[model samples]
Target: MSALPMLHRAVLAACLLSSIVAGCARKADLVITGGMVWTGLSSGRAQPGAVAIGRGRILAVGDSAAVAPYVGSRTRVLTAGGGLVMPGFVDGHTHFIDGGFQLASIDLRTAATPQEFIRRIAEYAQHLKPGQWITGGDWDHTLWKGAPLPRKDWIDSATPSNPVFVTRLDGHEALANSAAFRAANVSKDTPTPPGGEILRDPRTGEPQGIVKDQALGLVERAIPPPPPAERDSALARALAHAAALGVTATAHMNASWADFASYRRMERAGRMTLRVVLYLPLEQWRDIADTIRRQGQGDDWVRIGGCKGFMDGSAGSRTAYFFQPYADSAGYYGLLQHPEASMRAWIGAADSADLQVTVHAIGDRSNAMLLSIYDSVARAHGARDRRFRIEHAQHLRPEDMPAFGERGVIPSMQPYHAIDDGRWVEQRIGPERIRTTYAFRRLLDTGAKLAFGSDWTVAPLDPLLGVYAAVTRRTLDGKHPDGWVPEQKVTVAEALRAYTWG
Candidate 1:
């Protein structure tokens, strides 16, 4: 062979070797391997797969060998250990700051009896200073045998020094100790405000400490507000909770201006661990719109996008407006939080400003009314991506089910409510209405988008628990071994999509 031919062959082999090394040496900031990766697409599993991430974005996701090239000296590798790997969950609704405060405060949601409830308050009060008010217990009376509302008399002696104003698990009603009432100047003679009810003794006509709906403000206004430092701490705790839960984003519903300021401060300081979309109260829609118009709807990490309102109160409190009176209280239909005309005006104004609107509608009447209002608004405004949502769309009339999909409305639902509320909801509304309650499968079949959330503080913050509830429909009380309204149950994948993509 000629010497020239040997030299050319050697050069060609060197070039090929260099090309192979270059192709196998790409860098990644992080790599996750050994997982059953559900790409979250319609296509099924990516078994024994790996993911490569770079500069805060997914660089590659495929077979483990395919992603091996992106691993580098500085890359952080996480092993899934045969567990499922998918997109981080997005909570469609949350009271984030409130959840943080709940984490730090005494939790009474698990209290089983009246005595237990009083004992918990007594213990909690001892930890606080005399002037410091005790709040945020989130007690649930439904756990008790009779489901009796707590009275001031029950906790007055225990919370003598510290004024106590604690809410129920639903946050719609609250029990105020005698000290709190005196501090708020709420007397037996104090007339119940419109859209609110101050429960009084049947014979004595004295305030019984159980305040429902708008009446909660009567005592809440008197409680000292938390200082800015405390608020910041709570916000930080909530952010940490979100990160630990594998939640990448959350929509904060019914946040105050102070909450918005705190979120901005966190973002500015680079302390935010997840994305937040703040929704101010519907009454403040004009203010939010002005802020958005001036500053422009903010960046991905912090943005103002929607307004939240309430058509009625929660079912547990018996304030969820329904088409017919509750079974327990004949001729006593639930109260509407706002007049129909007022709701129309507020919704119309918000719609005109091009802000997304989400209203808390729990009962058949409230849901139907809101649907009508939304339909009217859509007809007048023509079509844009309004994405108007009904938070907690817990109960619905069968006829109104199709409107959600037809109108392009989103049902921002919390699956945990079905199992939690199932224990005794039949007693409140009766078995006939239970068919369409938490109709997850029915809504999806009708083409309505389902956005899942935790409604934290009212329920568990974990999305996995939510998925379990949706898929199983088994009541937490173990009464329904098979399922509660089994026809409404949805698949695990469907629930996951609602928590993530929806």
Candidate 2:
């Protein structure tokens, strides 16, 4: 057997850093074979393969015979067997730190009944100290039998001592307990903030404890934030979780300053296990611009040059800024999170500053208007690599679908949402609107770029689950055997590319 001299891992790193590595032998640090390998090429085809990796770089990738030379005495070989060997996933969207905390928090995502929902929260609260804030439930009202929006009263007795602030899986709405209300000083008379609403009881006109969109700050502000160490620890768990799933990098779609600091500190300390592209809130475009000027968008390990804006809320919350009223919600066409003019101005300013812009637009009208804003912004600034992205472009009008490709705007979407939301979306939007919802096939046909992610903390962090959801379009329930919207179902290869290359 041919063998190459073994070199230390540190020497391999030096060889990778410096072009001249004549002294260092060409040997693989890790080798994997015996599987179907996807190179993530334009062809979207998988080949029987082996891969040799060295110094955190792909030294060789081909059929077993091709990469055999790279295998050396020190090479660590892993057999994939019949499994798939593909490129590391690039999660296009995530709430990284929050996802970590949620990993250990109460899970109401699968609570099939309102009783079970309360039960989970109540049981989880039993372990917490009195007056301690209970957060990160990620409950879905749609999962319940009647799809009832949970009221604070429902869980008030259950969590009498704890201040509870549990959000819907979509993160657009939340159920805050009475304890939370008192802590936050949120009374029935408190005026609701624009772009948000505090739901109230129809009979007594009392606050019902359901907070939507911007008004969420009322209760959220009351809950004490995790300390720096805790935040850092959460980041560590999230990174470990992501790496375990073969995720090499992530794009934190709506990141906090603390999240960026965590990533920066980790990268500086060589604790960064995965890459991060931190996109700050778009409203602070000026700050993002200034930071870019000061830090030069950081290195590839942890970049920070993009801004994310919100165009609307989610469909689950009936706040997706649609063109028409939801079938279930009378006279409600949903609402935008920000005024059109304000969004346009901020987007234009950010474009002028040359920061990548991505906005959340889940409704058809929201996507349309945001597209127009992108078009106008790009036209105003002339042409460069703007790559304007529409995060959660979940619903699109037929006409606006073409605009995504024509205008070169990317639809940064979560495929898991297709399956999860598909379970109840028809009741909300009706059959007519459902045709265009999560229209991955048509969007790809239009030559639009697709960026798929888990929206972790909102959905599962596993990209494999996302791939299954996208390829099958199967709802979480067993009902959709064929698929939820089978016609819109993308191929495994296509979905894999979105999870990796995008």
Candidate 3:
């Protein structure tokens, strides 16, 4: 099944409804039958049906009788056995290249203890050449007994010879072993990058190994990038993994120029299996816009024209800027990834150049500020069709919630984070603030353009997992059986639209 772009996938049955009634002359390349076919229509209805696909496009979609005209002797028939035949999922957010590399790098997302986390890295390093950097361990410290952040000393003995910068699943923070600090020339004296923080031991003022938000770049610069061959291998694994999970395309949250080159190489070779829409960094808006104009927007296979910026860190990292202080820690808000003034200027210019702007805003304050800036910029510029998006609109103030739809801002969200985060979100913020967290049903009801994704490399890339979380809202810890923030749970069809459409 080809997972093409969503706008093209819109109205799955429109083609058949309009033209297939008279039937076509050519036989279908493939026919899917014996299933509840979801038309992915605005009506949000499904029925027993069949579909015919040919030449990389949806040929005819409807009941078996409606599709029989296109199926012939050579046409392939796929019986769903009463399963679902819906449009392929288009993940709204992801870190594609990182996800690809993480496929073979390490498995730390499930490391239940600090000891297990260090042990996994040590075990993986045993096979690597000495001094080689270890990257891409999406570990979640929250799963540990006390939910303590991992420190350098805990892993230094295990990884004495290797440099390590294992990221938390949220992508907002990382744990760097001692070797990595030396490699990056970081010291107790090194000033934290603007909009970033270095967690340090109080008395000695020594680094404790946790680097949040922008500070992650400090160690990242020292890590040698994967060679072209290794990148190709990673891409191969990523495409296969995505296809296996029924993901047809992605709106890559934070991609790079190097990553774009790799995608182009694959596209030119006709091996690009997954459709990717890359949102390069927002800081380099000039280069991003210039490149798009010089090369022309790519085809359905790969595309460019968007830039992603970050407003604040993630909630799990305690760096997602909020209206109030964290319940557990007083007088501390989240870290901002970019200054508000800089963000405003960059977004305005990018929009003027016709570049789509989607930014990361996980905290309530950041989300509110982002909405204001986007609204101001759109008004000042006298917009044509600027589809501003708030990536990870994770938290919201009730008053600011309806502005998303009123201003036509797209809430590009990840549903899986709700259930996973719900496991301990109340510990970070009080119960009152939890109501609007991942407000899926509320946003949809108010007419916001809610687009859902997995935030791959941070969360599972599986759309079904996201769907289950959205529909069920059951926390992973088994608490809140009725659903975590149950009022936010949406219907199956709404989740499908966010996955398949915008």
Tens-digit per-residue lDDT, 11-47, candidate 1:
3233224344346455889989998876545453446
lDDT of 3 by residue, 308-423 (tens): 99999988999999989999999888788888999999999998888889899989999999999999999998957778889989899999999989999999899999999999
Q: Candidate 3 versus the native: TM-score?
A: 0.95
The better-scoring model by lDDT among 1 and 3 is 3
lDDT of all predictions: 0.86, 0.84, 0.87
| Clashing residue pairs, backbone N/CA/C < 3 A, model 3 | none
TM-score of each: 0.91, 0.91, 0.95
Candidate 3: segments with Cα more than 4 A from true spot = 1-13, 19-27, 68-74
lDDT (Cα) of model 3: 0.87
Q: Which candidate number would show the highest TM-score if scored against the true structure?
A: 3
Candidate 2, superposed: residue stretches over 4 Å from native: 1-28, 33-35, 63-83
User: TM-score ranking from best to worst?
Assistant: 3, 1, 2
Per-residue CA lDDT of model 2 for 301-420, tens digit only, reads: 788848999989988899998888999879999988899999999999999999899899999998899999999888878999788898889998988898888888888889999988
- How many pairs collide in each candidate, listed in order? 0, 0, 0
Clashing pairs in 1: none
Q: What is candidate 1's local distance difference test score?
A: 0.86
* Model 1 per-residue lDDT at 87: 69
